[model samples]
Target: MTPDLAPQGALDRAWQRVADREAARLRDLFAAHPAPILPARAALARILAALILLGSAALTLLGLWLLLRALGLGGVSGGARVTSGLGAAPLLLFTWVARPRVPRVEGTPLPEAQAPQLHALVRRVGEAVGVTRPVHMVLSPDANAFMGLHGPRRTPVLGLGLALWYGLRPQERVALIAHELAHLKNGDPTRGGVVQAALNVLHQTVSVLWPDPVMEARAGLPEKLGNLILKGAALLPLGLIHLLLGLVGADQQAAEYRADLLAAQVAGSEAKAGLLDRLHMAHLLDSALHKQRHQPQRPDAFAEFRHMLDTLPPAQWAQVREEHARLRVRLDGSHPPTADRLRVVQAWPSEPLLTLSPEDAARLDAELQPFVAALEAAATEEYLYRTSG
Candidate 1:
């Protein structure tokens, strides 16, 4: 007869079983949900469309010049020359569209030496997810974690939001890191970079070419005619681009689900579910508190958030949970609904892992204390400036 394992040992074993099952389930999901090919095809279509537009504009300009020369009206240099220049303006507009710079997000870097424990945790998660460690870590005021490529070499940067870090349990924090690391493993950052670059170009092109009614209202007849020409060039192409982006957006949502599944494997299903549920509850509670307090100005919004979470009535909390469960998947959003994520986690076996001791929690808090004041100060300053402006 075999001796029975301890409770914690048994729990770990169960989680491992669940993880193995989830891996097989993921394979099946991939088979069932074939990758969306529409977006890639659409991107190619947009490139071709842009080339055609340029070619047509060139030919049209040449035709007008030739027409003037044929009709023996070539002696009218000023008007004919102006017409030729104006006819070629659309091509110049396309060049401007491609040149709009992508803006950088601002955050202070937290060096590994400054937060070794945090770095250790990140490293652990990255190893579990089979991805290289992030090249840099950043701290921001928002309640989220995201990874992206930075600089000329496109090194990976992992951003940790202080609010979310403070709010989550140790295991849940691991789940979050694992989720971000999974994005790197899944090649999402590189793929998204290409997709986003294309979309940015499309957006700039549309804005430049789309007629502004207010500007048109104040313009003379010649300016109005120019605006009309710009609008005519942009309208149909912009519509097609938007339609393609919608399909790409769907693919992005699918990526989020895949990331969540991978995170569940590393952090266990229970922790992932708890994290999602708490995030949803936090959103609901924060919204309710803002309404009740008339959006009270606070020196530290995270502190205010903690107070609200602690003070929320049990009855109201239950109601919020109910609302969270019933929430529908929002197609317009990048991520799937919280309820759906929770449902996926619920199907997996679960076990608690990496519970933080008081000493551990205190150590983590101590490491973050120095940065907290600065982050809070920045947040306060931004809030005041925005409200006043």
Candidate 2:
């Protein structure tokens, strides 16, 4: 009897050791370290604005000088001075003042009475890791949800799309939110958004300088000049630079797996296991929606090949649908291919899931009450896939 009791005690201690080790690893992974140093987005924006100002100023002066030269003032100013110096400054000012501002929409807040359930979920998970409740949550039709800075101090915005929720079970949905919160805690969303915004501005500037019209002039002085500037700017290697950003972005995506691990540890393994399946299902649903909205080209191979990969053959539409079904991952506009994300999540280690402490669970239940009510009241809107120009 003494020997039997000794073996049982040893087994219990061994299991406890394993659990401790796993928890320690998770804690380190989720620890809120200072954000990784990257180019400051606002600083970069200011720098870009300054460069534009200087360039426009120089161009204006050059145009002025050109105008003077045209009137027999400076060195051989050949060709008509079609551009006006005064006009150039005003044009620059206009561009500075007015550009299409990316519409900033706030996440819809669940009613105060309803905030308990969702809030509790976030609170339990957040308090467990020592972070604040998320600022707000949004529901969109697209199979997408992103965490990002909503305001000063980089508040977290959780866009939990309907497609994502529809595809996932309750447990999986909780895991997804947990994963997003982890991103907020890790500070990746704000950092990534900054990098993304900078890249976007740079790409926009390049496009403005020498668009396709210059290329279409079919070989002349203006064409040559435009080509020269375009070629030089091409040195920026937008594709390669974006690839590097994608890698950093992928690192953040991998961070999703780490977050899932945390969720499983704090919430339970059932939530974690369902993640991959739910993600794949959501991807499929989104792809189907996309196809329905965009009429696929006829099945002619030539037509399909000639068009962008996105424009599949109407005949081969069935095939395309089949391929997408087999793929089992969402094709995100920005993130890595769906298949790849699924693979990463699938590879994550499996361990016994842990539930939040009783107090935390109760709090989570309370906080999520409002969201649950909203979810119940919300009608299942049909997915209408449309791209706005």
Number of the top lDDT candidate: 1
**Considering every candidate listed, which one attains the maximal TM-score?**
1
CA displacement after TM-score superposition, residue 9 of candidate 1 (Å):
56
Tens digits of per-residue lDDT, candidate 2, 140-180, equal 54455666655544456667654455445455656666667
Question: TM-scores for all candidates?
Answer: 0.68, 0.50
lDDT of 2 at 105: 42
Which stretches of candidate 1 lie above 4 Å from their native place? 1-90, 100-103, 189-193, 210-234, 282-299, 329-332, 352-358, 381-389
lDDT of each: 0.63, 0.47
User: In model 1, what are the clashing residue pairs, if there are any?
Assistant: none
Q: Write candidate 1's Cα lDDT for 137-167 as tens digits.
A: 8998666778876665567888887767776
